[model samples]
Target: MARVVVDVMLKPEILDPQGQAVQRALPRLGFDGIAIAEVRQGKRFELEVDGPVDDAALTRIQELADTFLANTVIEDFTVKVEPS
Candidate 1:
């Protein structure tokens, strides 16, 4: 089996309230020593393939990412096939 990973993140111009909340709470959560300039949250998807990851499979995955996984207007995504 092979593994594929897709990472989706909001565009730089978009506001990430969830990430901001975490950042704001970090200091109160005993992470005061860590200085964070900004915080952004995203999503990760792991797909298990039954066989070798070929170009066709990657192309299909890319289509899925663009159509259903990530919102093109507000987000971007990257897909990578991991070694089995």
Candidate 2:
């Protein structure tokens, strides 16, 4: 089986409203002296499969990102695949 770890992230220049929300809450929680809470909400996924790095697997992974793992318009993702 092959195990894949995927990290999904928002673009660098894009603003993260979720992060902002957390930052705003920090001050109320007595969190001070911090410049800002740049929140990058992301996902860590573990995928188990039975195959080598074939074209079909690559295409299917991309499709997975486009279809569900990421918001195509405002997010980007990177994946690390390991053989087990």
Candidate 3:
């Protein structure tokens, strides 16, 4: 079997209110000296497929990421295939 990892994130031009909230809270939470200029919230999906890692599987995973895992209008995604 193989594992496909899908990482989805907002576009750079988009405003991330949740990420901003987390960034603002970090200082109040006593996380000092951490130079975090910005933070963006994202989603990670791990999919286990019943086959070896190959081009066809990667293509299908990419399709899934594009069609279901991420909102292509305002978000982008990357896929990684690994051994399960």
| Candidate whose lDDT is highest | 1
| Full-model lDDT for every candidate | 0.94, 0.77, 0.90
**Per TM-score, what order, best first?**
1, 3, 2
lDDT of 1 by residue, 8-28 (tens): 999999999999998999999
Instruction: Output the worst ten-in-a-row residue range by lDDT, candidate 2.
Output: 35-44
Which scores greater on lDDT, model 1 or model 3? 1
What is the clash count of model 2? 0
lDDT agreement of model 3 with the native: 0.90
Q: How many backbone clashes does candidate 3 have?
A: 0
Model 2 per-residue lDDT tens digits across residues 1-84: 788777788888888788678878887998877867466666777888776857789778878977799886888888778766
| Pairs of residues at least 3 apart in sequence or in different chains that clash in candidate 2 | none
User: What TM-score, to 2 decimals, does candidate 2 have?
Assistant: 0.65
Residues 1-84 of candidate 3: C-alpha lDDT, one tens digit per residue:
768889999999999999999999998999968799999999999998886878887897899899988999999899987655
